[model samples]
Target: MSYHNPVLLQESIDALAIKEDGVYVDVTFGGGGHSREILKRLGPNGRLFAFDQDPDALENEIEDERFTLIPENFRFISRFLRFHRIKKVDGILADLGVSSHQFDEAERGFSIRFDGDLDMRMNQKSKVSAKEIINSYSEEKLAEILFLYGELRNSRNIAKTIVESREGERIETSFQLKQVLQKYLPKAKEHKILAQIFQAVRIEVNEELDVLREFLQQMPNLLKEEGRLSVISYHSLEDRLVKRFIRTGLFSGEPEKDVFGNSDVPLQKVGKLIVPTPQEIKINNRARSAKLRIATLKV
Candidate 1:
């Protein structure tokens, strides 16, 4: 399980303002890159817990007395942490979206560059997969996913084409889906368009946005006063949610205010948004779109 270096490693961790004796959670412990760093900074009394639903990630778990790896999705962070008798934490870090390992593995079907089965389940045990969404979903439903998740303007035509093509033969493979969508893939922007299409399918299959919402809603209650949240998001959709939630404590719209014009937002933004330096992006192309946002529970 080879994973790329964690994006915004130093910056995101710095946002945590770690206390040597504090407890922390790395909610996306892909290859233990961030967790290892956290452990390095922690003292003997400090504790670190990580979560990853991917079976492949389990192989890369760290061997440290103070660190615990939870073999479950981060959306259940509150429940699982409760089971461990942990009701609050000093900081929480999330490196959101798919990991490099998931995209590099041909069988995962997460990469548009690969020609593999449409099995983009982060958790192998998940019931729904890209295959089921592509082949079984209705044209209208498919169109909605593409428009909303992929932000594709021509989603209706794409959905109509997919529904028609799959009628002749089931769209089981990535290359096969590409072939069906070839007419829409202009050479000038083929890669970008294909990426958007695949992104839509992957998000739908994984219920990523819903899971994110669930995980975020738990933050206010889970974090102690002034507890930190450091998140790195790859795409605009995820970034928007984090930005909005941090500012207004709601995914959309402004928070309600009383007669005094005071709104009770749960979290406050710590600083301006951060992105990977040109040097970092040069080293790892995947870091190009990474955006780091820091927040803390409002006092």
Candidate 2:
């Protein structure tokens, strides 16, 4: 039940440029660490809404009158906020990627160190588990996941091997999948390779990238005139999307320019990328890959 320290806590919250009376959001309210900090800086009139798809996160809900926890994925930020009779917020903070608690819990199947079921669904209620993907996906489909999600160079061969191995029996757990591809995991790079493979499967199971895009698309409409968007991404893919969206307001391609060579964008970058310091990383290793990007509505 312990949800260890959050990564890049102070830096991410500072990037929000929180206002005493303005409404805010913590889109990834896993351990409630960032949410708690936001509350500490808010005034009596300020309101905060947080989101988490995982049922486990409900346990960590903050108990402040000004704070409300939404037990759902952040991808539905706009829909859920509207349901609560809210349209605009002063600032939005998203700490993307998996929570440390997810990795520590062996049964969650988010860690390679443990022998657990292949159930990497952030929402335990989700029907599509990692087991289903590894056992049912065709070689071509599996290869695509490994190559695109995992960034594996020998994805085709890896997929073929998985297909061949799983044919004899169902791949029911993390350890089983590891054993099937034991040949690829050498002592020198075992952890790195296994992590990449697990990351690909987890991302696919949760539809992380698609959900991210959907959430980002809603930011412009959800924010107030001077509202801020503070996001922390754990990998290059998510960071790229945030960086691009902030710069040009699109995931791919350049923004259109007018006769004066001025282009319109929903949000403008607040500052350079913010990362955790050595002291913070030493305290929480997960902070190593964290990248915080802050942006505000374009004038």
Candidate 3:
């Protein structure tokens, strides 16, 4: 199966306002779909640097002189770019969240549809995995992950159940986890609820929130003056951080004013938030929850 189908392709590419001779970065090159599009718009003088933490994505790397593929987490994007001797870029694009390929591959344990091992590390090299999170984390920690990341209403009860059930037997696989939480599963739309559970586990296992904060902090430093940043987030938690950072240069609250009473926001919102069109979502259901936001550096 294909690795992924890039969501909001045209919308995201257009948002970048690509310059033919400019440098660009695709922070999440899941399937190389977005990278290919960016490359097509670049002139021979232009360069494209793509980053993906998952080693699986490196298999799809395109052999182009103008393009460089970095198999590293995007949280270290700035450091990697500097190592390559590129100080700043004209534009940057990030399509956050799990790739369809990851979810579709049963072995990856990113989806609730398939019964597989609960190992949801985007970077397989990472020490942590979903199994560790489910079995090792305390009830309080588990409840917090489900409540904050999954936004599940019955997080406390679900966490309690998981803790009680895994007292003796180890919960290792997706099926086992699902069976343990069967009682909490919604009757009419059980799949959706299960998905949320899996999502929460995946987020915690990967430390996604922390990575997003690190990546966003590096964006202002990576982009040149007036350079554009187009980010597509699939969940409210991710979107809220992106929105807050872009609006106030802070992740959660207003920017602190200097002694001169001037705020130091590094980015300026380019336009209102953009979402996939009905037509686009009709073809790709994964695009339904996507929210795209564009920002430009203040110089």
Candidate 4:
């Protein structure tokens, strides 16, 4: 019922530049907050499709005939949308990262504040969970996830600590993992460091970065000419990928150019990056790290 207020709600919807009778997709309909707003802007003929892999999120489905909620991951956006007889949408909006509801439900095991099970599967049926990553992953692999996803510099030491500690007792819960890596979490930066560690494991369990990359790669072909894409990402990793793809049409390296020196990039940015105002952050702390980037199919 009370999912975190969708981060950058007004700004994100506005970025879509909605048309009264156009088709659109909300690829991360966690709470249906943005989907609701898009509906408000649509006329009788306008249609909106949404995607959410989490079983819990399906409970918040909208009843409107104009809206359809697809219970699948956005990484498969192309396949599912085609099933609905949709080829191109006028716009696509994505609110990336974990939702507040996921964090609040201690049983879901997303928050470090709660001493819950170490399961952080966005999709309840997911085979991998944070528990498996933390308790069963190789030390080298764990270090790689922590360093790359969490951006922790001392990842090797953290991985070593986890491997050593798990040898005595299996780390099955959030608090257990925290206790095992106690030395890495100093008093001043404990929360931040722990959050990063959790983030890394969660990302690995969910394959978040890979999912984002797949979703973005489909955008160029998914949207109609001049169709808009509005994405709100909560961290640097996601933001960087979105920024780079919109610029180069490729996740990494420079876009190849023709002999005439014109690079064939698919999307052009619509505006400067948008972030929450201090006022918005004051109202919802979750909005603090949100960054919005808007883009449209290049002419």
Candidate 5:
């Protein structure tokens, strides 16, 4: 099967306003879909660099002279680009969150429907996996992940149940974990709750929130003056950080104003937030929760 079907393809590409001779970076290069679109817009003189921590993505790397695929986490985007002698770029595009390929492969263990080993590391090289988080994390830590990352309302009870159940045997698989949380799973909303649980595990395994903050901090320095940034975030936590960073150059609530009564933000919002059309969502259900935010770097 195809690795992934890029969400908001055209909308994201259009937001970049690609220049024929400009340099660009696709910070999340799953399946090369977005990279291919960017390459098509670039002239021979233009250059594109793509990053994907998943070793699986390297299989889809484009064999083009103008394109360079970096098989590493985008959290170090600036460091990697600089190593390639690229100080600044015309634009950067990031489609954050887990890719469809990761979820579909049962062995990768990203979905609740799968009865497979709980291993949700985006980078196969990573030491921690969902299995570790499920089996070893303390009840307090588990509750924190469920509440903050998954937004689960009954996090305390769920964490308590997990700790109680794991005393006899290690929770080894997705099915095992599901069985432990069965009581908390609402009958009519089982899938929804299960998804939330899996999401929480995945985020913890990958340290996604920390990675996102690190990547966003590098954007202003990586982008040239007036360069664009088009990011698509799937969950509220990710969206909140992106929105706050664009508005105030901070991931928190608000920025402190300078003595001159001006906020020292590096980015200027480009337009209103964009979402997938009903047609697009119908074609790819994963696009349903996707939110695109665009901004341009201040000179």
Candidate 6:
């Protein structure tokens, strides 16, 4: 059970400002760490609905009548909640980014330290694995993904190298891919660069950005009046989406003003952005990039 250490654990739960009997949702129940904390904060009658598309997470399901674990993706939050006869929840928590367990498990192919199959799907059944992305994507498309998702400046060259190497034989495993691009990874920055490269491939394989957008769009309808959304994102791309959506209700540009001359965003920021304390990060190195953003439905 070497799952994630739930970065900013107490802070995130406090962001929900939990009510004794309010309905809540943990949309990313990876290790069930956050969900277990939520259950502890709830009264006997309170309800918690958790979601995780990964089959591995199902083993950690909480044993309680008040808790329901939904074995599905959080992008389909609204639909699944409806099936459970829940229209509006008092609070929703999402911990974005890959779980620690995924990184630790070599076979999952989510870590740069491990040599494994290039299969980085969050859901095991996903059709597009990292192997397919590396082997099949056009150089231009690969460059785009690398630049946009990994923030790599030399994406064109990297993608070119991958394409050239794959022509001889499929880049089927993590080690094979690494060996192909070994020249690009100088000893000084090898780990950082490889992590970025793997990040780009993983994001595409899981359709993470698209999933985040879809889940955010459903928030206005899924939450009760004054309900809260407490999201913990591990990268700038995701943090920006949550921040922008909370501020303007749109991912890009500005939302039109309402009759009262105010922005029509459905959610308003609850407080300043929260990040892990140095002590917390010391305890869990993964918390280094973690950013927590809290918001509530507009009054």
Q: Candidate 6 residues 72-158, lDDT tens each?
A: 999999999999999999999999968999999999999888899999999998899999999999999999999999999999999
Clashing pairs in 6: none
lDDT for model 1 comes to: 0.94
Tens-digit lDDT track of model 5 for 1-299: 27899999999999999999999999899899999999999999999999998988888989999999999999999889989999999999999958889889999999887899999989999999999988899999999999999999889999999999999899999999999888887789999999888988899999999999999998888899889999999999899999989988987667778799987789999989999999999999989999999999986
Tens digits of per-residue lDDT for model 4 on 46-68? 99999999998999999999999
Tens-digit lDDT string for candidate 1 (1-299) = 25757888999999999999999999999988999989989999999999999999999989899999999999999999999999999999999968999999989999999999999999999999999999999999999999999999999999999999999999999999999999999999999999999999999988999989998999999998889999999999999999999989998789999999999999999999999999999988899999999999999
By the lDDT metric, which is better: model 2 or model 5?
Answer: 5
- Candidate 2 per-residue lDDT, tens place, 1-299, comes to 25857777788888878899989999999989999999999999999999998888899887899999998989999889999999899999999968888998989999999999999999989999999999999999999999999999999999999999988999998899999999999999999999999999999999999999999999899999888999999999899999999998998899999999999888999888888899888877888898999999987
Candidate 4 versus the native: TM-score? 0.99
Q: What is the lDDT for 164 in model 6?
A: 93
lDDT of each: 0.94, 0.91, 0.91, 0.93, 0.92, 0.93
Number of backbone collisions per candidate:
0, 0, 0, 0, 0, 0
Q: What lDDT is obtained when candidate 2 is compared to the true structure?
A: 0.91
Question: Which residue segments of model 2 deviate by more than 4 Å?
Answer: none
Provide the global lDDT of candidate 6 against the true structure.
0.93
Off by over 4 Å in 4: none
The C-alpha TM-scores of every prediction are: 0.99, 0.98, 0.97, 0.99, 0.98, 0.98
